[model samples]
Target: MRVLLAGGGTAGHTSPLLATAAVLAEAGDDITCLGTPKGLEVTLIPEAGFPLELVPPVPLPRRPNADLVRLPANLRRTVKATLGVIDRVRPDVVVGFGGYVSVPAYLAARRRKLPIVVHEGNALPGVANKLGARLTTHVAVSFPDTDLRGATYTGLPIRRQIADLDRDALRDEGRRYFGLDADRPTILVTGGSQGARRINTTMAAASRDLAAAGVQVLHAAGRPEEVELDRRAGDPPYVVERYIDRIDLAYAAADLVVCRSGANTVTEVAAVGLPAVFVPLPIGNGEQALNAHPVVGAGGGLLVEDAAFTPAWVDSAVVPLVTSPERLAHMSRAASGIVRRDAAEQLAQLIHRAAQERR
Candidate 1:
């Protein structure tokens, strides 16, 4: 099968796009990704070894009347550009992962009457997927309660390593790889690939407490310069790196995770059974909080608003939680079964089914 998959910008969109692409590639499908030049997609997509086609981005503006007035023309031009790519690729199916790029892909695919599969990675559908969902009966969602027309619950697609990780088996090796003590409690703190300013500051402020409690912190500070730790020469390891390319190993090394609740992070953490303190990004459609809800509701994780995740909260809530092995074990068990590990495969099958039925 030939497919055109669309999404871009942050890891939230690109990570799932790559996960689904991996599954499709395994099935011998010809996959062409649609993205704008601006985004992680420019590097991530090509590095993943898939052919990517660029279309002009047609961003949806929150500003009323001004940019909104020009939206129709902007959308039309991008849709035309997207159609040009679609025409050349001649895909049997078009799968959209909800971003500005997806809007153009959806519009073009709809214009050509092609089979369209829409995947909503957040608890709430984004603008592109919301419109795409209206054009197709085949819509998939990461969270169960995502309010869209005929959306199926097929949890977010995650990396294969994360899906197949044996955290218990890899614990010792992962610790040694990161130069952490084998028996010390570990917390993996990340704020996606670019890092969160608030998370960086708050965690940096609480570094002393975390280190003093005999806890090992693997901080994936996207901005490494922002993370200032005041640990003594012999305190429990407080390793800071800009970003962890080997996230699977990091998961193996962690007993708990403190990170943003972007759909991808929440889904991956839940899939790997890593108990988490999810600090939702304090922006956008409030979907980050909603994305963490099912796992949090299932007793798998704790959700704190971004503003509330301070050093004091870390001292009072997080330090105690990390130190408690029994609670961490229970939380890990609860987090494990919350998200499906075969989400990428599920989405791959759905895409193939849509193509077969329409073709």
Candidate 2:
């Protein structure tokens, strides 16, 4: 089977597509990725040894004036590019993970009469997924209560490297790799792959407080800020980086996590059974807040509003959890309950079924 996976813009959007593609590849499907040239997908897709077809960047305009100016041209380009790729690949199915790029890919799939699947990884449906859902043959979701109706709750598809880690070995390796004193509690702070400036500042200010309390920190400060953070927070008690390629190690070592509430991050935290304090990004139609509700509601994590986020709040909320083993254990159990490890398998099965039916 030939499958075309489409998504881009950020790691949050493309990671799940890569995860699903991995499963399909393992199942003997020839997988290709269609993505915007400058998006993370360009680097990530090629790094994974998958064939990546780059199209022009078609960023959705948020402002009225910009939308009026660019919409027609972007739409035309998107349609043309998508159609050209579809005709060339002749894929059996096109699976979209949700982003602006996914919109045209889905449309092209429909035009070709190929099976299309949309996987929404947010509690609220993204604009692209909302459009795709209407025409898609199957909708897979990360969160169970996502806005897209008629979607199966397949959880978020995480990369196999993280998914297949041996739990006990991961824990031991993580502790040693980060040079954490086995007796000290570890707290991981990340603002997604890009890093949140606010979160980074707050965590940096509170680093001393964390260290004074005998807590170790693994901070992913995004690309530009990683060096600054490393210079600011030196030594074994604080390990800082711009991006975490080995997230399994970070997740395994962390007793608690403070991060943004991107859908993929939330699900991955739950899958790894780590307690978290989620500070959703305060933008883009309040979607991140919606993503955090389920995890917060399940007692797996705390949802800290971006405006309410402060070093004190981080200290207050996280310090107690880290200090109390019982609380940490309960939160871990709650987090574990929120994810299904077979999410990718479930989504792949649905796609296969849909493709067969289409045939």
Candidate 3:
């Protein structure tokens, strides 16, 4: 089977797209990806060893303005480019992961009368995906309750490492790899690729208290220079890194995680059965809060608003949670079956079924 997948912009959309692509390729499907030049996909798709097709991105303006006036023309141009890609590739099916590029891909696939599969990664559906949902019967969402035209509760596709991880088995090696103490409780903090200023500062502010509680922190602060921790010679190691290339190790080392609730972040953390403190990004239509809600409701995690996740709250809530073995174990167990383990393989099967149906 030949599959053309459309997704890009950030890791939220790209990670799942790539994960599914990996499974499809291993099963002997020819995989091609569609993306906009402006998005991270310009490099990411090619780096993942897939053929990438570029189309102009149609960024819908929120307010009525010059961009809004130019929207139709821009969309038409992108749709034409996408159509050209589709004709040349001649895919059995077109799969869309919601992003600016997906709108054009969905429109083009329909114009060609091709089989289309749409995947929505957020709790709240995006406009591109909403439009795609109407065009096809196969619509899959990351969260269970995401309302769309024809929604199926296919869990978010995640990396192979996370899907196969056994935290208990790797804990000792992970601790040694990060140079963390064998006896101390470990917490991991991250705010995705670009990092979060609030999380970085607040975690730094509460570092002393956390250290005093005999806990270790693996803080992957997006911006290292901005988030400075006043470290003493013998404080429980508050190790900071700009980014973590190998997040599997980080998960193995952590009993708890404090991070943003992006779709990819939430799904990956939950899939690994890590207890979490999900601080949803204060902006953006409240989707992050919605993304973390199910886990929080299931007792797998706690959700905190950006404005309220202060150093004081960390001392009160986070410090105690890390020290309590019983609560951590409970949260870990709760987080364990929320995200399906074989989502990448499941999504691959769905894509193949869609392709075979078209025949």
Candidate 4:
């Protein structure tokens, strides 16, 4: 099979795109990607060893403005560029995860009458996927309640490492690797690849309290020097790092997690069976909060506002929870129950069905 997958900018879009691409590649499919030079896909797609076709990003501005006035011409130019790429790649099917570049790719694929698969990762569909879904019957979504036409609840496709993770089996090695005490309850704190300033600061502030309660913290602070732990002597329970390359290890070591509620994060955490205190990004379409809803509503996790996720809340709520092994175990079971582990395979089958239709 030959495929052209489109998505970029944020990790939320790119992660699922790559997850599906990996599955297709394993089945001997030739995969190509469409993205913009400015987007993260420039680095990520190539690193995954797939051919990436670059296109100019055409962003549809909100509200009436000069940019909105230029939308038609910009969209036309991008669609034309995308058409050229489509002609050369001649993919049997095009799969798109919502992003700025996806709009043109979807439009071009629609014009070519190619099978187009649209994956919306958020509980609320984005404009690009929403537009694309109007033209195709293959629409896959992460959350069950996503309002999209012809949508299938495929869940979020996480990386292979996350999908295959065995936290109980890897706990000792993961804790030892991170210099955390194996006997103590460990909490992993992260704000994603770029990091969340609010989450970082709050986690740092709560580290001392976390240590005092005989709990260990593995904090991924994100930036170069965002978190600096002050330890008097021996190994403090709180360990801080700028970023974590091996998040599987983090998941293995963590009994609980404190992080943002992006679709990828929520899905990954739940997949690993780690109960989480989700702090959704305050800005943007309120999708982050919605992304956490199903998991939290399922008794798998707890959702808190960014502003309310203070050190005091950590002392009051988090400390109590982690100390209670029975409660943590119950929540862990709930979290794991919410994951559809076959999501990557499910999406791969959808792509295969769509691609097969062209033949």
Candidate 1, backbone clash total = 0
Model 3 misplacement above 4 A: none
Instruction: Report, for all candidates in order, the number of backbone clashes.
Output: 0, 0, 0, 0
Per-candidate Cα lDDT values, in order, are: 0.92, 0.83, 0.92, 0.90
Sort the candidates on lDDT, descending order.
Answer: 1, 3, 4, 2
How do the residues 31-130 of candidate 3 rate in per-residue lDDT, one tens digit apiece?
9999988888888889989999898889977689998999999999999999999889999999999999999999999999998999999999999999
- Model 4: per-residue lDDT, tens digit, 9-117? 9889888999999999999999999999888898988998889999888887767899888899999999999999999999999999998899999999989999999
Give candidate 4's error at residue 262 in angstroms.
0.5
- Comparing 1 with 2 on lDDT, the higher-scoring candidate is 1
RMSD of each: 1.0, 2.3, 1.0, 1.3
Candidate 2 runs further than 4 Å off:
223-236
Better of 2 and 4 by lDDT: 4
Model 4 clash pairs are none
- The candidate 3 region of ten consecutive residues with least summed lDDT is 225-234
1-359, model 1: which lDDT tens digit per residue? 99999999878899999999999999999999999989899999999999999977777997787679889999899999999998999999999998889998988998898999999999988888989999999999998888989989888999899999999999998999888899998999999999988889898899889888988899999999999877688888888999898899999999999999999999999999999999998888899999999999999999999889899999999999999999999999999989999999999999999999665
